[model samples]
Target: MQKLQTLFAPSAIAVVGATDREGAVGGAIFQNLQKNFEGKVYPVNPNRDVIFDKECYQDLASAPEVELVVIVVPAKVALQVLEEAGKVNIDNVIVISAGFSEQNDSGEMLEQQLIGIADEYDINLIGPNSLGVISTHSGMNASFGPALPQTGTISFMSQSGAFVTATIDWAIQRNIGFKDIVSLGNKAVVDETDLIKEWGDDPETDVVIGYLEGIDDGREFIDAARDVVMDTPVVLIKSGQTEAGARAAASHTGTMAGSEQAYEAGLRQAGVLRADSAEQLFDYARALAGLPSLDQNTVAVVTNAGGPGVMATDVIGESKLSLATFTEETIDAFDDCLPAGANIYNPVDIIGDAPVDRFVEAIKIALSDRNVGAVLVLGAPTAVLSYADLAEEMGALAESHDKPIMGCLMGGKEADAATKILDKHGIPNYFDPARAITGLEGLARLNTIRSREYHSFEPFDDVNSDRVEQILSDAVADGRSRLGVESMGILEAYGIPTPEGEIATSPSEAKEIAEQYENSVVMKIVSPDIVHKSDMGGVDVGVKQRDVEDAYERIVTNARRYQPDATILGVQVQQQVDLSETTELIIGTKYDSQFGQLVLAGLGGIFVEIFEDTAVRVGPVTDREAATMLSELRAYPLLRGARGRPAADEQSIIEIIQRLSQLVEDFPAIMELDINPVVARPNDAVAIDLRLTIDEGKL
Candidate 1:
């Protein structure tokens, strides 16, 4: 936090490439700084005798001591300027120059040099391709973008310079103010994690909003965000949600652990609210900033128009929040004040002809009700009512009451003045009742997150880490990047139940193994190369002892025909597990490139391929979080005994998931693991099939 203070609250600043040339980036920065910043500003330009009427220094050596420096030169010369600034002991820098990392190979190399120099000098660098930084609290506009915003509690950070500029323009038109804004272009040193921690502790900041294209360190970001959300709500909009990788996945986990899924899981686990659009980001931010955290999900709506009231009620019904059931006393009060035709139900319609006094009385009654956690007031442009009066009364009533109040002013010309009045009093007004309901829903979601207790992974005493390590070591030593049937041993070592199985090289051997099982047996072709054995007709279930010989021969023949060059290691004979009265689930793990070790679970078999319904979380997952992951699945009802079916062994499934999380945590080289179709009964669960993909490079 101290290091970040220099970047945001520097006493003195120097623009390294400052100039008086019109429309130049350096000149724009210098002019803005001179006009808005309260601190002393210096210009470093060898050619110019003066810049913006301030005497320009040839270099840092000629200039007075400054706490921060802004570099706007080319990428090639930026490093040299940083070196000079370091020599003079400048502790902070905002490299507003481009052509680094975002450009070609030469640019990437230059960025590495800048990072090296920053480390050597212990300097806090913002970016090599950044716009700049702005601090409304300190009255600083050090950026080369537009003017600074009015002082407010919401702080914003973005990766794109265009996004920052566009958001600022939109904010100004909407009268939205900010505490701080930073354009994190190619974040070389100071990234989102640093800013989150700094803003989390900033007394002036009430909420933090971010626009990110990608993150450098997923784990670090999650940890920082987790801490920040405890005090200040963090709303983020991460782009590239649909841009998943196209690699040939060897397991169900890898197929489902797309880049977007990992990010979603990570952010949810960290208690951050994800916004789907720019509007939602600010909508959620404004509500979180202006209103107190919602302690309950029940909401009451008071409206002068029945149609809009119905709309608001419908939206509330769709949201996580429920319509507040007014107490008998509150209902009686509303009936006494409102006209006879007015509906004093949950919507509490006071009629369109009702004046400002009637509206105010109804709102007061609803807000005063103990059952109401929040209230939404809706007003149409009626001739009898003055929007100005209603807006003022609503604002005051909201302030007087302890619960949050959101307004829906439902027309354009007539509601404009009322909207501004609501804004002035820190009451958010939406043009549509649905939007107001959505904002209230965001508050309820935030309350849910705040109410949850923090959970951490607890290691099981029965886990044998050494044994798991040796199993992976042997797989790598045998010149195999993937483990075949041998990986089942790894699951058993972790206490995960697997079907009884034995490898048979010939049909006679397969028949001998099948004879041991009373009911029936299953046979599958074993090969390191074939990830999906079912695709090549290599799996045969419910095989009798007499048919095992023929099934083995047919499976081996199919494998040879499918891929002639593939390595075939005979057939696996296993006792067939019945799934007629059981639930089939997939429990798997994958190592994400940015965020390591993600656990995935979902409904197994054709449902997994068709619906793609799965839930993921960063490993190692705790017992409680594992349950959460399962509940997040769209098929959760199946496990909960839907349609009068007996509930599957949910606890056992969670235990297996936790074990899989531990497996990947122990051996990161086990890049992808899939225990597809783990048959779960009412009391027990067993892994029906297993596949493990190893990446020795990670080890």
Candidate 2:
């Protein structure tokens, strides 16, 4: 906080490369500072003796020492200026120059050099290619953008310079104010996590909004966001929702973690509200900033027209919120206030020609209901009542109630005037009922997040870490990064149930193993190089004792033909368990480059391959989170005994997921682990096949 205080609220500032040329970036920044900033501003440029009718110093040596410096020179000259500023004891900088990491190879080199210089001198740098920073509370507009916004509680941070300029323009036109604004260009030094922490402690900020192209460290960002959301809401709009967008994000921000699924899972885990578009970002922010946090998900609607009231009710039903049921006492109150023939249900329609007193009475009755968590008032244009009078009454009622109250005055000219009245009283007004309902939905989501409990992963003492370590160590020693059928011992060490199996080097050994089992047996080729054993024809199921030797030979032949260079150890012979009555499920874990370990589960076999129905959560997942992950999957109904089939062993599946999460948390080198076709019956679950991929680099 101390470091950032100087960057955002410095006592004095110096603008290197300052100019008076019209339409120039440096000139624009200087002009903005001169107009709004309530501090000393020094213009440093060797070419100019005077800038903006103020004395301009030729260099840093001639200028007075300042706490912050804005560098708008070329990349080559910015480095020299940084060294000079360091000598003059300037510890804060915002480099507005382009041609940094955002450019080609030479620019990347220059950025690295800038990082090294900042580290050596203990300087806090904002950007080498940035749009700059602004603080409305301090009357500081240090950017090369437009004028400062109106003072308000929302603070915005963006990774794109153009987005910052556009959002500022948009906010000004909409009368949306901000406490602070930042453009995190390149993010070489100050990243999103830093700003989250800073603004989380800032008393002036009621909400923190962000536009992120990519995240550098997923776990760190999640932790930071989690802490901030505990005190203030954090609304974010993340790009890269598609594969093409992911690729573009990587190229744009130089970030490696471009997986949109990972970002979504991580943000949800951190309790951050994600907006699909720029407008929704502020839409959520405004509601969060203006209204009290909703404690429940039920909303009550009061309307003058039935159509808009029904529309609001439908949208609420579609959202995660439910319409509130009116209590008997509340129903009696509404019936007494409203005229005859008025509908007194969840929508609480008071008829079209209702007067101001009738509208006020309906809202007051709805707000007084204990079952109603929030209130939505919808009004259509009517000749009997004025929209402004109803808006004023609703705004006063909103201010008096602790619950969130939103309004939808469905019209243009008169509604616009009414909206301004509501806005002045800090009551969010929407033009449509759906928009008002969506805003209430945002409040409900925040309530859920606030009430959620985050549990830590507790290590089970029964896990045999030594046994699992030996298996991974031996595989690495043999120059094999992947563990094949022989690695079932690792699963057994973690207490995950697996079918009894034995490695047979020859056909005689395979037949001998099959003779031990009364029912049919299964044979699979054991090799490190083959990932998808079925694709290579390396598996044979339902092999009787008479055909065991042939099955073993055929599996080996098929594997060798598919990959001649693969080192096939032997055939894995095991008792074939009937899965016709059981659910085929897949449980796996992979180390994501950004978010560390992630656990995935879904229906196995062709359903998993074609439908791609899976649920993901970051490790080390709690028991509750594991169950929640399963419930999120589209195939969860199948596991819950759909179609009169007995329910699969849900507890067993959750325990396996918990154990897998623990395994990955303990041994990060176990990069990718898959257990496909885990036959789950009524009371038991067992893994039929296991594959483990280890990254020796981590080891």
Candidate 3:
């Protein structure tokens, strides 16, 4: 945070490569700084003696004392400047030069060298290809962007420099204020986690907003984000998850829990609100920055026109917020003050001819209701009504209530004039009713995130770590990438219930194992090469003791015929439980590149792909989160006894999920794991099949 303060609020800044050259990036940066920067600026250029009436120095060593250095030179020269800064003991630098890791291999190497220099000098470096920084408090506009934003609590950051400049311009048009702005280009050293932590704890920052392309460290990001969200809401637009980490997975968990899923789970667990669009990013940020938290999540609409009122109602119906049911007392109050033709309901239509006073009366009555959590005022320019007057009333009404109030001043010229009045009191006014409700939804969503209980992952001491380690080690030593039912001991070692199963080397051994079962048994070909035993005709269910040898021979023959070169690693004879009394489910884990192990739970069996109903969370998942995951699944109703059926052992399933989360967290080498057809009975849950893939290199 201290380092961030230095980067944002440095007293003296030297612009390396600054010049009077037209359209040059360095000149633009210096011009921007000259606009409002309260601190002294030193312009550096080898060819020119003076730039913009200020004397220019040849390099950092020649420049007078400067607290921070902004490098805008070419890639190689930027490295030389950085080395010079290190030698001069300048510990704060923002490299606005491009051609870093985002470029070619040589550029990546250059970025690494920059990091090396910064480390040697104990420098707090921002970026190798960044757009520079801005602080409204310091009156600095160091970035080569458009006009400085008006002072406000919402501070913005973006990985794309173009996005920063464009958003700053757009934010001005939309009347959005920014306290500080950052363009995190290349993000070699200072990344999203650093910005979030710095701004989240700052007293001036009401809400932390950012546009992040990637999170460098997942665990560190989650921890940093979690630390601040309890006090300040963090909204981000993470835009690079499309088709990321999408591979031909060996298990359902691996195939479904892609990089996008990992990011979703990570962000959700960290309690950070994710905005899918640019409009949504500001919509949430504005609401968090300006309005009070929407606690009840039920909204009442007050409008002059019925159509726009209906639109607000529709948006409220679709949002997490509900259409507020006004109390009878509030309805009666509206009736007394409104015109005869006015409809005094939840969306109390005060008639098209309603005056500004009538509109105020309707909204005031709505706010007075105990049932109404929030209020949305919609108005179309009418002959008798004054939108500006109503805007003033809306501002006053906003101050009177503790609840959030959104206004839909629906018009062009009239609404345009009224918006300025609403802005003063922090009342968000939109041209459309839907946008107003959407903004209200953001407040509700933020409240939900803050209200949620965050739990810690308590390690289950009952788990046998030693046994699990040996199982994974043996598999890795064998050079086996995939483990079949033969490695069920891994599940058993984690205290997850698996059926009585053991590898049978011969037909006699298979018969002996089947005879021990009360009835018939399940025989499956045990080969690391055969992933789907059923598809290869390598499995036979209900194999009686008498016919166990024949079934084993047929299974082995089928597997050998399917893949003649495949390793014939004997067979697995397992006890068969009644499928009719239990529900089949699939639970699996996949190590995501960004967020590590992602534990997945949902409908099992071969139809998992068809259903595609699953819940995912980054490990290690706590008991509450595991239960929440199960409840999130579409098949959760079935587990909860939806159709007069006895409830499955959901508690047992949660326990198994926690154990699996621990297993994956304990050994990240277990890259992908699938426990399909894990039977869930009324009292107990049993694992039916196991498929695991371990990364030998990670082990």
Query: Taking the tens digit of each residue's C-alpha lDDT, what string does model 3 give over 639-696?
Result: 9898888899999999999999899999998999999978999999998999999888
Cα lDDT of model 2 by residue, 1-699, tens digit: 235877778788899999999988999999999887888999999999999899999998898878889999999999999988878878888999989889999999999999888887888888878999998887889998887888889989999989999998988877788998999899888888888888899888999999999887889988888889989899999997877644322110012223666788899998899999887787789898888888788898888888888788778879999999989999898888888989888888899989888999888889899999998888888899899999899888987899888888889999888988888777778887877877788888888898888887776778999999999999899998877788999989999999888999999999998889999998999997787688889998898899989888899999989999999999999988877779888888877788888888877763456666777787888899999988998889999999999999999999999998899999999777878767888999898888777888887
Clashing pairs in 3: none
How do all the candidates rank in terms of lDDT, highest first?
A: 1, 3, 2
Q: For candidate 1, which ten residues in a row score worst on lDDT? A: 1-10
Q: Rate the local accuracy (lDDT) of all candidates.
A: 0.87, 0.86, 0.86
Question: What TM-score does each of the candidates earn?
Answer: 0.97, 0.93, 0.97
- Best of the candidates, lDDT: 1
What is the Cα-based TM-score of model 1? Answer: 0.97
What TM-score quantifies how close candidate 3 is to the native fold?
0.97
Candidate 1 lDDT tens digits, 161-280: 999999888888777889999999999988988899999999889999999998888898888888889899999999999864577788767878878889998889878999999988
Q: Which stretches of candidate 2 lie over 4 Å from their true place?
A: 1-3, 245-258, 560-567, 578-581
lDDT of the structure predicted as candidate 2: 0.86
Looking at model 3, how many pairs of residues clash? 0
Model 1 clash pairs? none
